[model samples]
Target: MIPNAIAVDSATGAPIVLAQAEHGAESHGAEHMASTPGEHGGAFPPFDSSTYASQLIWLAITFGALYFIVAKIALPRLANIVEGRAERIESDLAEAKRLRAESKAAEDAFLKAQADARAKASAIATEAREAVARQSDENRRRLDTEMAAKLAAAETQIAATKQAAMGNVRGIAADAAAAIVERLSGATPATAEIEQAVDATLAR
Candidate 1:
């Protein structure tokens, strides 16, 4: 069982045992804190005045090293890269201009060549037409000459045939006359006399 009663000290009329224990605990906590003041100080060493100059020197050294690397090495590398890129771009532009000029020249040359070829073809065609026309005219002239010669030969043949037919008619008329005189007069006419008489009658 636990006693729930008030405690009293007979000597000083107070609770001496609990008061002494609380006082001893408070003093012990204060002694522990005073003994470890250096541990707490170490957590924030930069706030300590004893090492302030050394921190400033280290900070300056680190900043100088970073500045040297950036200025001397990294910045030069970046500048070279930018310059090379610019040169490449300029070279590409020059090449493009040259190609464009060449293309234009080629197009002009092709057009000229096409015009020349067309002109040559037209000239050849014109010459061929002229040659064909000349040949046709020559053929017509030759045919006309041959026709004139043929017509003249036919007229000459007709005249010769008419002269031979007239010569036969004269001989037949003389024979017919001699035969009629012999029947009517009982005397035959002389051959020479008959021929002479027929010739004279034809002349009259």
Candidate 2:
């Protein structure tokens, strides 16, 4: 006969079987043990959806705080520093331009002064040369006037000596003729007779 059930004996730690009443035949029993207290062997509990939502909310709040700090505080300070640097560069360029213009003006003044000095020097030299030429001409005119006066005085002296010598020669000739008449005629000839003889001899 077939057995009707099978069971485990907890106290003896062994399996047991029971037979049917009419023929004593055996059969298979249950495969698994029953559930007990404090055991967790079933499907996991359902996911906590609210826990994930709370975590995401905290992350968003932290990220927004950081973004506000960077945008409002850090970025404006950096922008001010950049603007100040640009203004400083522009001021330096303006100062350099002014210095260059001042240097150019100084150079122009120096060149003008040099030109004026040269012109004055040339004028002084011209005046000195003209003065020397004028003095030389005056000296030459004075010398010529003195030489002419001396030459006139010498000519007058020569003329006076020549006239005196001619007068003495005429007087000597008259005395010699009177002496010749006294010797030849044994007496002095009359002035009329001498004059007639000199005229007749000159005509012949």
Candidate 3:
């Protein structure tokens, strides 16, 4: 606030004294704000414009140290890990290829064995069939020969029996005729004459 230029009493002496006192109070407040900056708001030491060059120099040193550690140490370890993984993958692929080839060869061998077994079985079956056929034919021929011999023997026996029966019938007929002649004429006929008559009748 501005001090009153005119006093209440309208005297010049009181007005001059008031103005001097106000001036002195304002000068004292200005001195107190300049000496103790912390008492009010002010710039920190690091952010102060007078210390800018020193802050920049320290920032450059820290950045250089971090860059060197990443480039020389961390990067080499990461490269070795990548190369190890790549070599392992290549070896695994080669082993898998070799196993596949062996599996194919085994399958081929199994198929060939099956084919050979089938051919051998077929040949054995054919040979068995031919042998059976030959045995059957031999049996049939033997039976036929046995039946022919039996039939011929039976026919010869029948012919001999028939001849003997005929001879008996002729003799009986001759005796019956001789007896009939004796009964009619009251005298016996001669045996030779009776035999001749019987023979002539039997011939007709």
Candidate 4:
């Protein structure tokens, strides 16, 4: 609290101290009135400059302490946490790259296996087709050989039958000639003469 300026009593020519009439306590009465010349020779006690100066100094000290704590301790801790997070992110990215490479390798192996299987299947099919063709060719050749043998046997039988039939026709013609000669001469031919005439007719 501030003290007010004192007013002099002109009639008495002395300093007049205003009093709080009902309070009866000096500390309480001083708070309510101006100071007299008896209280510090009629002047204020430098207006509490020391108190203001002390308050300003303490405020500055507290601000400096708080600033130092934040700059030296709290900021470094925060930086460390940020750095750790960044390192963790880098590690995670590296792990992802490794897994991707493994996946690609597996895919390549699967593709190669599929290609090999297809090639083997194609080869098998070709071999089977070739086998079938070979069997068909062998069957055709066997049938042609059997047919040729049968045709040759049939031709030989036909030729033997034709020769036998021609021999029978010649014997019939000779018997008829002998019977005509006997009728014209009115005599029977001897055995030797008949044999010689049959031979000559056959030769002619």
Candidate 5:
């Protein structure tokens, strides 16, 4: 800015005024060139040096918000849901185990009851068969006793009938012989002698 003169205050010979004015003009020109570069000269917005601090600040805010949401709202809720599901699954598994144990007990009881029933039935059947056998034996013994008594009575009655028939036949024969002797020889036989003769002939 100073061309060919050494400028100074006329009285005190100070050099402050023109130097300050030249320095201010130079700083203004540099500021203008820095603010308005030519086309295709400065970097893209994202890579620009002037905006790096603002971009980093906004990035930090976004990351902090995401972290806060995950820590405070999203993660706690998800953890609660997962824990509830796990607890429910554990309770359900315990219930299932209990049910399985109960089922086993019930099945054992049922089997025992079935065995008892079968044993009872077998005992009943055995008793029934024994009773039937006893009844059949008693009936057979009773029939045999009746048949023996009837046979003895019938034999006794046939012997009595034969004795009476023989007595009647001997009398009739003695009478017939006496009649025949009277008609043929004019004589009657003695009763004692005729009886003795009939007995001897029957014996032979």
Candidate 6:
């Protein structure tokens, strides 16, 4: 609110009075028609040269106070918030990297374990195959030995049978010759002579 009287002179330090009638001339009943003398743009009183120093002083004070609030209060709080967010982001990134490394290590370990298991299984399978082959070969050799023994025994039995049959054949031949001689000559041949003769023929 501006008073009808203005205090503080421009240079002489004397009080300046603005009469109510003088103020009314610049208005029509209740509406403003113009601003105070030396002021431009109605309702904007800062353009008045009479109050230029005061306006500048207030402007400087307000600007300084705003600057102080921004520098000392708002800026520090904002900086702290920004720094805290930055640290949190960095921490999250580090944690993510750690987790990724752990996951990669675990994957590598699993792969190694799988490969080892496969190798062990292959070794076991190879050993089993070799064992089976060795067993089969041993069985074949044992069977061959048993068969050879059986073959030898059978051969001995055949030879013995053949010798027995041959012995009976010689006796039959002697008996047949004795009977034939008796029939033809009407006399029986001596058994001793027949046996001797058959023995001689067989020896030849």
Instruction: Highest TM-score: give the candidate number.
Output: 6
- The C-alpha RMSD in Å for every predicted model, in order, reads 18.5, 21.7, 17.8, 15.8, 15.9, 12.1
Q: In angstroms, how far off is 130's CA in candidate 4?
A: 5.7
lDDT of each: 0.73, 0.64, 0.72, 0.69, 0.74, 0.76
lDDT of 2 by residue, 108-168 (tens): 9999999999999999999999999999999998998898999888888888887787557
Comparison by TM-score, 5 against 6, better one? 6
Quote model 6's TM-score. 0.43
lDDT for predicted candidate 1 compared with the true structure? 0.73
Off by over 4 Å in 6: 1-46, 130-204
lDDT of 1 by residue, 74-139 (tens): 999998999889999999999999999999999999999999999999999999999999899889
- Weakest ten-residue segment in model 4 by summed lDDT: 1-10
* TM-score against truth, every candidate: 0.35, 0.34, 0.35, 0.36, 0.40, 0.43
Question: Sorted on lDDT, highest at the top, how do the candidates line up?
Answer: 6, 5, 1, 3, 4, 2
TM-score of candidate 5 against the unseen true structure: 0.40
Cα lDDT tens digits for candidate 5, 180-201: 7778888777888877877787
Give per-residue CA lDDT, model 4, range 1-204, as digits (tens).
123322334234342332322332533454434443334333344574424665788989998999998899988998889988998999999999999999999999999999999999999999999999989999998998888888888888887887787567566656666677788987877756776677787768
lDDT of 6: 0.76
Error of 2 at 189 (Å): 50
Model 5 CA deviation exceeding 4 Å by range: 1-42, 123-204
Task: For model 5, give the 10-residue run with minimal summed lDDT.
Answer: 1-10
> What shift in Å separates residue 77 of candidate 6 from its native position after superposition?
1.4
Task: Name the lDDT of candidate 3.
Answer: 0.72
How many residue pairs clash in all the candidates, one count each? 0, 6, 0, 0, 0, 0
Model 1 stretches with alpha carbons more than 4 Å out: 1-52, 119-204
lDDT of 2 at 160: 86
The digit string of per-residue lDDT tens for model 6 on 52-169 reads 6657899999999999999999999999999999999999999999999999999999999999999999999999999999999999999999999999999999999988987887
